[model samples]
Target chain A: MGTVTGKVLPQPTRDEIRVETVLQALADPVRLRMVAELANSAEPIPCGHFDVEVGKSTVTHHVRTLREAGVIEVRQVGTARASTLRKDDLDARFPGLLTGVLSGVD
Target chain B: MGTVTGKVLPQPTRDEIRVETVLQALADPVRLRMVAELANSAEPIPCGHFDVEVGKSTVTHHVRTLREAGVIEVRQVGTARASTLRKDDLDARFPGLLTGVLSGVD
Candidate 1:
């Protein structure tokens, strides 16, 4: 059971992180809010910190989508998982793209 | 019926446009290809010129999504509807963002 749950986790490759995926991941309002919050944070945020009103299953789905799209990175620390925006990856993939959009989010 | 049909067509306000909507619209593979083709074109392309294998209804839906998200603009010309990338709007909204990612598509 433990191994099965572990196998279900996402492990996205660099090649899979296409611009379309990144865009799609950011398209949802809920996901965008989460991304905005993460962008504004100085440290990695626990997944639970996001106040999205979706069901737990949907929240997991959104997080997985973002993670697979390379918009964010997740790491397990103790019993909690921390997510951080992959600002550097996005910058390298499309220079000034993320920063520019983020500025307009306000 | 004419009024209803016209009203069904989207007329998105500037404020209605959001980054997440744009990102979501481009996330689909077919839409991304369409955007790439539009980006490569110097002028507007007829909606039917896109060879996407999806059903006509689905294609229309995709186009509507792009149009509503402010990624593309549509105009009626004779019997056909033409679509063009809203490059200038995107530029104003997020400077150098589209051009940068487009360069990496190849």
Candidate 2:
């Protein structure tokens, strides 16, 4: 929720999150890499830090897709948008999912 | 791998399996329901047993998608096709994924 700009981005509550949407968000290569990077980090990252092949609008679309699916949290941080994996919510909804998906990479 | 019929279907080896593809396959409502039913079952189920809104060809397509993603195994049994979730391979590749995804239901 951004008060100054008055732009309220929709976010699903932890209990409202569903596995189907989360799986769809993680199915994409670019989105999954973004999640992998965010998952490994201790801090939330600005969306600009994500390396993707798509153009500006496409990137925004992908991020929105993930955000809407409740796989990640995104909020405006000054001029930049900060994003982080909703690990706790996901783990709570579907236990061991975070570890399961992350373990495939390392 | 099946023999006698000579109808060869493609499948990813356990080591070659990727999370993105598996997630993509599981993202579908029909496919995921099919998987959930199969995952819970101790025995392989005939594809005909699945109740879906799609036509026969469409169901075939969905099953093929899941099979190629290496999330499930499908083999020819007489004239019908038998499908089973590849729980062992998936669990080994992405530790706890089976439990993670399945636990969402119950």
Candidate 3:
């Protein structure tokens, strides 16, 4: 069966994203870890790769929240969802936020 | 008449602060504006100085939320509650986070 390709999640555009949503999305421990890890890596990571304490579905939920907040972009890569930080967009919107916050985390 | 002094609202110590809570507190527009203002000022400002659109109770609620989240310190200064961002504590915890985030905001 043919599967839908590209972004499976509907997300706010970079311009549409709000500061409150970005901060709220990052407030969750699991989600923050995800973002911190993404901030460290140069390449997009697959969803299954994160070692968050929560369950798989919970991870999916967190990822969706991040995507919707415009902090991260989730692309349908084959059958897997690849996620990456919207660094440029966020930096443009909030300046050095990602770098500053991510620097404190592992 | 004699009144209470120092931290009218119970708050987390500098050490007890958490990243998630900081993000959650800053996620709010009013709270974020308060923080942005505090970031700009060298001196602590009274709670009433904030120009939030909400009512008194609501502003108090937001201030309490920010205080408890460890983003700000509230000290009862001469019966007026003065709030200041825990800049050093937050900077130590999350380097450049406040400056970076605060820079983009007014």
> Which regions in candidate 3 have their CA more than 4 angstroms from the true location?
A1-15, B1-13, B41-43
> All models, DockQ values?
0.43, 0.69, 0.52
Could you tell me the lDDT of residue B67 within candidate 1? Answer: 91
lDDT of 1 by residue, B9-95 (tens): 354665566776677777688988889899998777777888688887888888888898888888776677778888888887777
Q: Candidate 3 on B1-106: residue-level lDDT in tens?
A: 3332565568877768877778888887888888888887777788788877888888889989998888888888777998877888888877767876775575
When 1 and 3 are scored with DockQ, the better candidate is 3
TM-score of chain B of each: 0.82, 0.86, 0.86
lDDT of 2 by residue, B32-51 (tens): 88888887777777777886
The model with the greatest DockQ is: 2
Model 3: per-residue Cα lDDT over A1-106, one tens digit each = 1332576567787678777778888878889999988887777778889978878899889989999999988888778998888888988777767876786565
- Could you tell me which 10 consecutive residues in candidate 1 chain B have the lowest summed lDDT? B1-10
Q: DockQ: which is higher, 2 or 3?
A: 2
Candidate 1 residue lDDT tens string, A1-106: 1111111236566555777667777778888888989999887776787878988778778888889888888877667677878887788787876776675575
